[model samples]
Target: MNTLTTIERRAMQAISTDSGRMLIVAADQRNGMKAAIKDAPNGSDAISREELAEAKADLVRHLANHAPAILLDPEVALPAIVDDGVLSRGTALVVGLDASGFETVDGLKHTRFVPGVTPRTARELGGDAAKMLWYTRPDRQGLDSRVAGEIRDLVAECEAEGLLLIVELLTYQLEGESDEDYAAAFPQLVADGAALAVACGAKVLKLQYPGSAEGVSAVTAAAQGVPWAVLSAGVDHETFIEQIRVAMAGGAAGAMAGRSLWKDSLSISADTREQLLTERALPRLRELAAVVDAR
Candidate 1:
């Protein structure tokens, strides 16, 4: 898999130790607000309308310093960022490729933001890789022949660019679905030539880490031998921290995080936030990495 260890090391060494360990800075800034997925847990509760609105604004406000991977719009956006060269190594500058969501059942392939970037853009971005944000489901609910075909093409394009495509789990989450069906369908999804694409080639596979003591086991079992990271699915700050810890405890390679990085506690200090993210936020991540290394 294209783990980008060298890039990670370089980024970490360069980062301020005052910031502590690397808490992925996901920077993919999407278009306008999106509707919450049907089955979004505490959808009506966790984040109130006011809070969610601020989350979007916070995304814009923190553009300069945000970490992890920034999922960018596929349209004529990202110009300022492009000029700034945010794509340099030590960062995962991702492009969001939203399929047929919020409307048509048939998946459509189009670049909505980050205009100039296509699968071909990565090579020029000075990028180690780009994630395809692949989110598909069953025959109709998720993937079908049409969606499958589009994914195949994307894979080809990403592969040609030597990029890594991470299948996003949020799509299904929004659609009110579970990975059980998707995981069960993954073998078939790959068998359908969707796996043969260029982008998915040996990169990190991402999955949801259900919030449970045994949750990681389920995720690991689903991932099998493939390299994978567990996501917290935009949980609250405390829960988010616990989620990352649990994921690391379960042997996840790393985390594909969002929300938590942006969601601040009611009265948290910047110093406390840094410690939580780098230290307590990812205690298990360090432990897991050491485990992988020892092996």
Candidate 2:
């Protein structure tokens, strides 16, 4: 039904459906993905890489370490976190673009971008899917046709290169912007890359956090005519679960998250949340998929 339902999609699904099981650690932090992984959840201990070895069931995490309490850091230190025996273990490590190239200077200080993890030199440091972030307000860098074309070409090239290029439609609407600016960018981003994403082997269309049902609804609507899976922006844990529920409720395809799961003091005492996904979220996703299928 959707495009590129290849061996990879099967692999993506074998990890399980995106109900509660599709929980990606929200590494896109305030400072960036690196800062986001500082503390995973509130009122709990951070979920460390060592603890992650203990996480059973389906989980999509950005590979990163954490402080004990009160912070989060999600910048992927190395691509091997996902490629080298990591995703093979069933954890979808959403690798980021090159960090060494993404940062810039601000006033007397420098601002570093904490994307999934920058594309590195290691050949084994490959990603399940490549993610690209376009800034709307602060940089407005996403608006350049040259940059846009480069991104578009990259997705296409990844597939041609036998890799998958999955782009994330992200934004933080600052500078007295209207909701229109937020809503306007997605279609164009998709229009610019849809064929390329599918042709290049991307499995899904990951969207930024839509602040309201209307914004998320727009995402779902835009995705309806396209052949890609859609998801809302990844926020906090409580909100992340709720957002997944609402997107499923709204008949969205699924979601891609970065900060909520890893940006906390995560001491998951029990698999209650994991059990909830199996018991509650998965069933609900099945229903949503059915609704979309019926259409």
Candidate 3:
């Protein structure tokens, strides 16, 4: 495995506390957040940009105090949160480089980086690490090479800028596959994606739960000593917490989660939202933190 660069090392250190584990709160959803809010009571199907920004900032203000780091989007949340000092001292900032919109072409879905915010730009904006999400499937012809090239470019740019690169690996089914087939295929797909990300020079891996303890072990092993964390994927709080415990037991460093912790806040009034964050989200974050520390 390749050694981490000075900037990469610093980025990793920034995201991880003295415990050497990463517990991050991710609020980088742009389109997804808007969609969730549409379903919220008294919420409009047409969510304005300003509303989305406010919601994301609220998430940071309420949740950032509990985690060592947060993942944010450059286009929406970064400016307001940074200007307002929502992120607490000693909390690392990770910026998402991928743009909104997932395109389906020829039965395969693809996502790519947005224009303007490069790894170097993220570093300039005070981000310690740059993150992107990629969809991976071994059976999907030619997709891996395309995505791998993107990862390679991102890693190279981040290395030059001294920022760590965190890649979130996801898998989608081919045409005609059932949900059960997709679930069954996810474990090996995640393991393969982790190895690919590490080989492509990602410093950290943010991954979906591979569905079983054995799957978790395989992913960690394939990571080749690169730290890997589980993403919540909008599962319930209890389910995500159990996932953290099982993942940590199988050698994951910790978690980088969103939605699961705060999705319920979408429909509530501002005061009640804050109350829920304090009463519900903070306790859950603390619980996950304890799990990571115990590991």
Instruction: Name the weakest run of 10 consecutive residues (lDDT summed) in model 2.
Output: 64-73
Write model 1 residue lDDT over 1-295, tens digit each, in one string: 3343454334333321223322344435322223321222554345444443343333433331334344444332343455544343433455454432344343422222233557666546544345544444433433334444555566567666655555444334224446687565444443222232223333445555554656566555545444455555666555655666666666655655555444332111233434444544244334423332332
Q: What is the lDDT for 174 in model 1? A: 24
Clash count list over all predictions:
25, 42, 0
* Alpha-carbon RMSD, candidate 3: 2.0
The C-alpha stretches of model 3 lying farther than 4 A from their native spots are 38-44, 141-144
Candidates 1 and 3 compared by lDDT, better number: 3
Best by TM-score: 3
Sorted by lDDT, highest first, which candidate order results? 3, 1, 2
Instruction: Write down the TM-score for model 2.
Output: 0.54
Query: Using TM-score as the measure, what is the rank order of every candidate, best first?
Result: 3, 1, 2
Off by over 4 Å in 1: 1-23, 31-71, 74-77, 85-92, 99-101, 106-117, 138-144, 171-202, 264-295
Better of 1 and 2 by lDDT: 1
- Cα lDDT of model 2 overall? 0.41
- Location of the lowest summed lDDT over 10 successive residues in candidate 1: 30-39
